[model samples]
Target: MNDNAATGEKINQQARAWYVRLGSEQAGADDWHDFTVWLEADPKHIDAYDRVELALLDISPQETKSGVLNNPVGKPEENPSDKIIVLQEKRRLLKPIPRSYLAGIAATFIAALALLFSANIFQSPANIQHYATNIGEYENIVLSDGTRINLNTNTKLSVQMGKKIRAVTLYSGEAYFDIAQDTKRGFIVNVKDTIITDIGTAFSVNFYESTLSVSVAHGIVDMQSPVQKVRLTKGQKAVRLSGAKTMTIASVEIDNISTWRDGVLVFENAPLSSIVPELNRYFKTSIVLMDEQTAALTFSGVLNISDQDKMINSIEALLPVRVMDDGRQILLSGKQ
Candidate 1:
């Protein structure tokens, strides 16, 4: 093995020894101090700790509680031979088992690497990629299972695909999923801890991190959480808290949610306080309203995102306010 690989193997072996010592309360104070000192000595020490933590977590629960390593010493402490016997027996039993587990992890890592290195992985007829737009940027992506995804503004996602299954993880963002229907194989998108399994549905998922908001534009989407699963129809909305696994269903007005897809934002009975942040996201400009009273007032109207001047005029028209522009910053207040 190479030097780095050899070092890693040695660390893994030491970790098991440390774990046993920790379990039996046999690790001396000096040993614990030394380990801590080494851990803080280099960044690689932290990485090694993370790997060992993963392996420990992956170990079978039965193996952990089996009391296999009752003593770090080979035998009972009455004599020197006891320590030798215990040490020898422990090494023999643990060496083979940990190597086997490491081999399995190596195999999975190799397979993933091969798939990534292959030139035709994305070009295959069976695989489709999906992409989406950012704030002021557009994208088109084809998924590994032939699904297309278009995302919009401040989105996050994870992708999983192979011959058998295709999955995407969307934590907080908006995405347009153009699912390619396959009877034998299905595509799924994960939102937080929930899953949106396609039932031949072409739809869009808009998720907000701070608020529990899920707006569905078209098709029947299956949303599954830890406690419950629900099928959402077109023009239906799901809202819940950030930590909540379940969603509350509501009938949504399609225009309000879908308008953002068309470069228009409409605020009906929306507080000026709420509107400022929305405007900040759509435009490169920063908007500040000096009057808290005016910011609290609710405004109802549609604003085409393309025409900033017109949009500003419309907002000012409704409120007794004046807009002053200073570079990219705009201040709105009571007419003065």
Candidate 2:
């Protein structure tokens, strides 16, 4: 690529990063300071930022018909001579702009935004709010719809509330939901091909190793796909294996289930393979099985997460396995 083309591309990327960061509630005074410094670095930087602002506005532009209504045909207004902060503030930007200047910036940013979308550097939908729990972490989230969600370790999801329905797309991992009762509006969770619709319920859904499991503790839930539908009620569980045509429903002891809300993990004849992956979510280091034979071994137990070492020892005692801790990674092999 030519030097100017490469340079413009880099500027656009940097500007987009700054734009996203600044929009977050986590952006603090230091972030704002760094952003202002970056904004003042070069003239091309200003152009790049303007493009970012314009693209963000374009992301949701129903109310502000920014093209024809805001920017009309005219000579570009002269830059203010008195260092006015209202129109072009150092900290708060893109509030008020000269019509002609805004038109030029919007045109340029639209081109850059198209490139960004095509390259896949930006994928967040305008209306969706994203939440995630890092490995070894758990969080309680309250959505705009007044629904409560307990996100387990290594989980990521997005929420979008509408007038008629509340939708969430679980990208990965697990969560327990205390969905608010709304007869006029229903709650839905989209996991792979399965669409979980709630009927005023509290439940948990887990997506692991391409398999989806839904457990209803209270009320009823319907897991629907294009081919089949399964209804689950209190103390009931359903599993949809990857590429399966229908879900298998079973019964669980709701009172004894070790849910994330209580910080307990209950395994019912869970294989070493499944247990190891779940354990990794609560610890910084991972436990790796030495072979597939070790992974196939099954054990049933309730693990208290307060002490991870105790749980590891319990696993080792139940199965004929030895725990080899290497500080960074844990290794499990058959006991001699």
Candidate 3:
């Protein structure tokens, strides 16, 4: 083993010894002090000790009832023997029958540690590869599993593929996925607090504020959160508001929903407040609505996102509002 690996093994051995000694009635004051000093000396020592205690509980439940997990090193006794831990360990080996049985117990401890290490590895943001689009920029990505992802403007996502799992976490904006079938491995997408599991199908997810809207173009998906469970099929859409126990379901024209990926955004009765944000994503110049009344106004139409000035003028004609262009921005207010 290399230096780092060798050091890790040494810490595990020390932690195992300390755990057993503290559990018995023979641990002295010096044993407890040495443990505290070792624990304080390195941050990894504490983690190692925790794993040791957990492993003992899993392999030896009867010992757990003895209160080995009470404090810094379990409950301490005033009159304790330093040999108590050594004698207890000897009693365990007196009944062993074969080499394979000893190996099995060792494997169990290693497996428990492997699980902890895997969780730590995935918790780091760097584990997954990141893909993001700037304002007005769109992208098409083909994953290793033959999954096609089309990202809309200002969208960000992360993907991590393992041997038996494919996981993606959507950070902002929207995207469309065409997933390939893999019966042995499941595909999971995380949106806000909800999890979307694809059953060999394709879908789209839009995240805005605390709400997430999922539209399925083809196939089926199971959407779940803390308090709600919903299954959706092709040509169906669902919207979930933050803190709501249930989702609002509706049928949609799946063909026109994600048209923005092709340079066209079609909105059916979309609000002014919502429209302005979509417009801002495609233009460097910002659109500001002056009043709440104007923001609540809704309109329906197809917008060509390529031409910002024409789109702004088009909205001005559709709504009873005046649009003014200062030297820096466009301002809209109820005609007055």
Candidate 4:
């Protein structure tokens, strides 16, 4: 064999190894850093890795259906060690051919793809991942498929990525979802008894005090309950009250729904009663209305939640109200 052909073969092997290594659970930040260095060391490395990835994608369905790849929802393998032996046998069969031969080249490419599938690069749905944020805390998460999720204060959720679906179960609090469109796999969110399926959209789901609220910012979302199903488009919101079989759909101001993400709350002539509960979500200190009349007062403004004292001062200055802090809680009463 010529030295050029031998060098190309070696580069292909290195690319395959890097691809599998990165897809595995063990790959870390350092591994990724080194991979970048290697990829940039030679332009051929980029082409080689791309070829390996494309080949795997082409053969994945056949391998998955034939049981060569791990089924996302299947039961555990009785003999996990057997997978290594099978991979070794396949490698041995492909290793003896000359690369100059067309059949040999095809066999080698298929062997590389087989190695990836046999290694179980795609995570199974059974491997659910749980994420949470503490009171007054927020978090951002990006999934393997490029979907982005922003968890609001005091939130908990679990994510499962499968071959046909990308699912998230919101156990509590609120989350904004920016779904990456994939024609093959659908994205769905489970909030209480409601199932929200994205149709190439960006949306938010808030579950608080036995109530489920969904607001769509872009594209479309299909929400299904036990009794009914509804589709929401941009500027639309759905609210399902506790113990109700059906949800109410309404038009909403889209910008107001996501202002909390910027550490501020925007209220347009919103009453004190409705606003206080939202403020409580971000702070340990409770804000209580001293009288019914105080709760009835309306305020229209933006309050920065980062500073509790400043937020309270702004509320008092804007409305006909007096704020008293007893250390335990902040009490609001109509100014006499």
Candidate 2 error regions (>4 Å) = 1-125, 256-258, 291-297, 317-319
Candidate 2, residues 46-117, lDDT tens digits: the string is 999997788654222111112321221232222211211111111221133346555655554465445333
Q: List model 1 lDDT by residue over 1-336, tens digit each.
A: 999899887776766665666556567888888778767777777677777778755222110122222221122222211111111211221122244445554554465445333423544633433323334333346655577776554455555564555667665556778788877656777665556777776677766533445566667777765556788888888765555435799988876764555556777899877777666554456677677787778888776554567678878787888889988678888775
TM-score of each: 0.54, 0.59, 0.60, 0.63
The candidate maximizing lDDT is 4
Backbone clashes under 3 angstroms, per model: 22, 0, 1, 0
Please provide, for model 4 over 1-336, each residue's C-alpha lDDT reduced to its tens digit, 9 standing for 90 to 100. 899999999999999899989988799999999999999999999999999998864222100112221222233222222211111211221233234455643554465345333333466644677776656666677889999998777677878787767778887788999999999988889876577889998999998665789999999999877557899999999998765656899998988877667777788888877788778777777888888899788888888776678789888778889888999878898899
For each candidate in turn, give its C-alpha RMSD to the true structure in angstroms. 27.5, 25.9, 29.3, 24.7
Question: Considering summed lDDT, which 10 consecutive residues are worst modelled in model 3?
Answer: 60-69
| Top TM-score prediction, candidate number | 4
Q: Positional deviation of 130 in candidate 1, in angstroms?
A: 8.7
Between the candidate structures 1 and 2, which one is better when assessed by lDDT?
A: 2
lDDT per residue for candidate 3 within 1-336, as digits (tens), equals 899999999999998888878888888998899889989999999999989887754222111122221211212232222221211221222232356544654554465346334544545644567776555666778888899988776567778776566787787778999998988778878875577889988899987544689999999999876456799999899888654546889998988768876676788899887777667666656777878888889989877676677778788889999998895777889986
